[model samples]
Target: MVTRKLAAVAAALLTGTLSLTACSTGSSGGGSSDPGDSQLNKVLKAGELRVAVLPDFPPWAVQKADGSFEGYEIDIAHELADSLGVKLKLVSTDGDSRLPMLQSNRVDVNVSAWTSTNERAQTAGFTIPYDAHGAGVLFKKGADITSYQDLAGKSVSVARGSTNDTILTNDFPSAKPVRFDAISDVISAVKTGKVDAALESSYTVAQAAKSDPELEAISNPPLDPQLVSMGVLPGDQVWINYLNNFIRNLIASGEDNKLHEKWLGEPLASIVSVQGNAA
Candidate 1:
């Protein structure tokens, strides 16, 4: 029965776009909501909700060997499917490949940990953020670098197509930015001394530094961090609004922090300021 329901939802979502009004009734997330109330309804009706995920990003979204997904994003995606009243179908990909899944319509939506930026915004519409943290360069302990400008004419390695890449590419056009296939590889680049410094999300860098004592973090550059958002194909206000309210409700209900701990293993309080509209 659930399988049939997912099939139905897929048909409708694939048929065309859905208006926000058609999916959301401005109704509050009053309970353990079903995916039926918001833009998720379109997916539920289609009988299957195609969700893109990246397993390499721990504490955010990770794929398990048993075929189940682990991490905060996966937990929330499950909640999203529940709210939409459909089955949650997982589509796996890395950070660099997630956008392609969304663009090709191979997946209906991307719940993989996605950082929003002006460049990505042009390709995909974003919901409000679930997590926000700054990107910093990780160097060997006792390094002399103070800011992004200090890295001038030096080799900088970053995850391909990540927000850090967009920022460094646009901000420090003179710096040499090398693209690694994954965030982990970029992190490895720093430890391997393949690059002068490696740029990565603080969440990942902090985790890496905790386990390895040699990597030192440079706090100054791009003091502004990136906010992670749910990615959707453009023109789905119904889905967009649904996701926005879901995120807002996540913060309001305290589930946001709970999920953070569930996957990240600690409360990431430093990024709270980036959770909503900035001051």
Candidate 2:
């Protein structure tokens, strides 16, 4: 009996030792795997590129009556997926939802025309800028405002929670900022003369002006220019680099200019020009 008990105790000790060794091996294997391999490899393995986009932002992205998305960013998203030899899976998102979708891993990347700000850079990685624009005011063609300073003591419209709103509140505190939920609403307010002007991105303002004969977009002094980039989850250097290369290729091949002309009605601005290219 004593011999049998001793043998049982020895077997238990050996089993525990093997279990510990297996755990250690598994951990070491995981640690040794290249960090950069995971995100890009997972995307390739899935055979579909998931991208988040805003559907209501015209010229950048627009949702059609048929429920399909179209526009410059949509085309760009499709092209990126094509380059990966993967199907494009667009996850419809809004301005507020884009970053959350990326952080939660619901999408591999966000092509929502995000302005790369210092505060945003802290949370996510941004590829080299694909577009550059500044803030401007859109108003009726004969409106009194001629410069940013003219906004003083005037009622201006801005999308709530946007950089434009922040700019108005922080810089032009004297201006009465009428906040709206959508950029469309801000534009509408200005169009109907409910507001004297609407502060918005230069591209958006320009598009609005082109579409409406009574409206005009002006950026005389040019508010802070924003560099728009694709957003990926933080720490994905591999994915960021790939996107940067893809953007460079798009510029070199003239696809970027094509899209810009198709949507914005002009060749893409020199602001988007790559290092070696003449804008």
Candidate 3:
């Protein structure tokens, strides 16, 4: 059933025929308490929802050869636009551009695999978590790594400005860190032997390893697990609240689980849970 739903969604996206509601309506969790005072109103009145999304994060957001995007994050963005009864405009972003794009008003919201952090919270508003994942070490089969401690002296590739980059920087200072602007570049660094390993999302690591028999991802006891949410401009309490309610409705309708399974091929419970950043 989930596969069928995903197929339909994908088809709709490819054909630019997503079915949307007649108007934006908040969920039972408290429908936009300040709709007129935030980006929510602006988006609804404009009849379009501009969203920032990663163009290269596979399983989250991937740009196809045809220049169309389809992934878990893409689905979420589509759903949000659908609920608001608006046209969805996807603006491409990278790891470092999400917050900046929101701040510049180039996009209304960010759904680009954004992990919630206290530091980020100070600069942007995040809706309640809609997804979660943990970090893992991706290496070739014969690499010396077996545990986090093994990474101490090894060279690891990480996407610049990503949480994985922070982990390598703060937790394993002795390890050499190779920073790339895109997750694909980080993974390619590992595959091409430019780096000994890549620190990335466990799900992404798994997907990469699955596509390459020579690669392996060490995800047991996943590291630095994080909760993921949509990012909005700071102080947009009304927009933030509306997205939170939308996520609640997504969960209640079981659509979140269906989407998760379709993209990640596992139930949400199988993913590690974390308390988020200590700082």
Candidate 4:
């Protein structure tokens, strides 16, 4: 349990400045048209939902000093399980192993900062996105650098298989990109000047920047803005539809934004246009 004083410190420490991006995407899969089935029954029958989380990804999922999990996504997962009337079991995973954990059924859901993208969606379905996650570069404070083009000849760190990698690969193309096994590795590389700066998630990187006064997040945070989703076993129409509706209802009732504020410490207030396509 959290002592009130500590909780206040955490809440105060968590803050962000979100800039909305224009969302546009491919054609929506449309409705299940015929309303295929419900996956809620299977989940309820199991009596528990196993969720995989990246323990080091702060503001999303992280292991507390007490050796248990706590973070925005971790708390949200618990609430989701509660709503479903099932026990939510969390498994700590490294980011690289998240997909494998889901593939092997080691966990029923992957809620650890899993960004929804076109390629990933080919293998897995993401919930109708609740937020647009922007990326950023963490650099030594007062070093004076911003914008993707500034990375021209400098070595920039990025995580393997991350949207940041994809963006830098396509966007920079000229920078000597250093790929790491995890975000923590990339952050370390930047702090030690192993690389000029590291491409990382703005949300978590902001927390890192605050924690380490030596490092500060660069301006012009990358904004490809992928949709975040809960990953489940593929080909289960019942489960897909059920989760889709669950998200729809959550958005309808305003809990979706609440979850964002609760975990991220910023209301996800955006000039989001009502669009049919998945962003």
Q: Looking at model 1, how many pairs of residues clash? A: 22
- lDDT score at residue 63, model 2, on the 0-100 scale: 83
lDDT, model 1, position 169 = 89
Each model's total of backbone clashes: 22, 0, 0, 2
Instruction: Write the residue-wise lDDT of candidate 1 on 1-279 in tens digits.
Output: 112343344334444443334332221211112234333555655767788887766657666778787877888877767655668898888777776676666787788778777777766767777876677777778666767677788788988877788767887787899898877688788888888888776666666777889987765543456777888765555567666655666665566777788767766464652453242
Cα lDDT, model 2, residue 27? 24
Q: On residues 93-193, what C-alpha lDDT tens digit does candidate 3 reach at each position?
A: 99898877876779999999899989877666778788888898899999998888898888999999899999899999999999999889999999999
Please state the error at residue 17 of candidate 4 in Å.
43
Best lDDT among the predictions, by candidate number: 3
> What does candidate 1 score on TM?
0.74
**lDDT to native, each model:** 0.68, 0.74, 0.78, 0.66
**Each candidate's TM vs. the true structure?**
0.74, 0.80, 0.84, 0.78
Model 1 RMSD vs true structure: 7.6
lDDT of 4 by residue, 145-197 (tens): 76656777778898888888888888888888899877778888988889888
Clashing pairs in 2: none
Candidate 3 off by > 4 Å: 1-34, 270-279
* Per-residue lDDT over 1-279 for candidate 2, one digit per residue giving the tens place of the 0 to 100 score: 011232232233333321221111112112111323435556667777899987667888878899999988999888887777668888887667767786677898889878888987776677888887678889999888889989999999997777788889998999999998777788899989999999987778888998899998875856987888998766655556556667877776788788878887777667787631732
Answer with 1 or 2, whichever has the higher lDDT.
2
Best by TM-score: 3
Give the clashing residue pairs of candidate 3, or none.
Answer: none
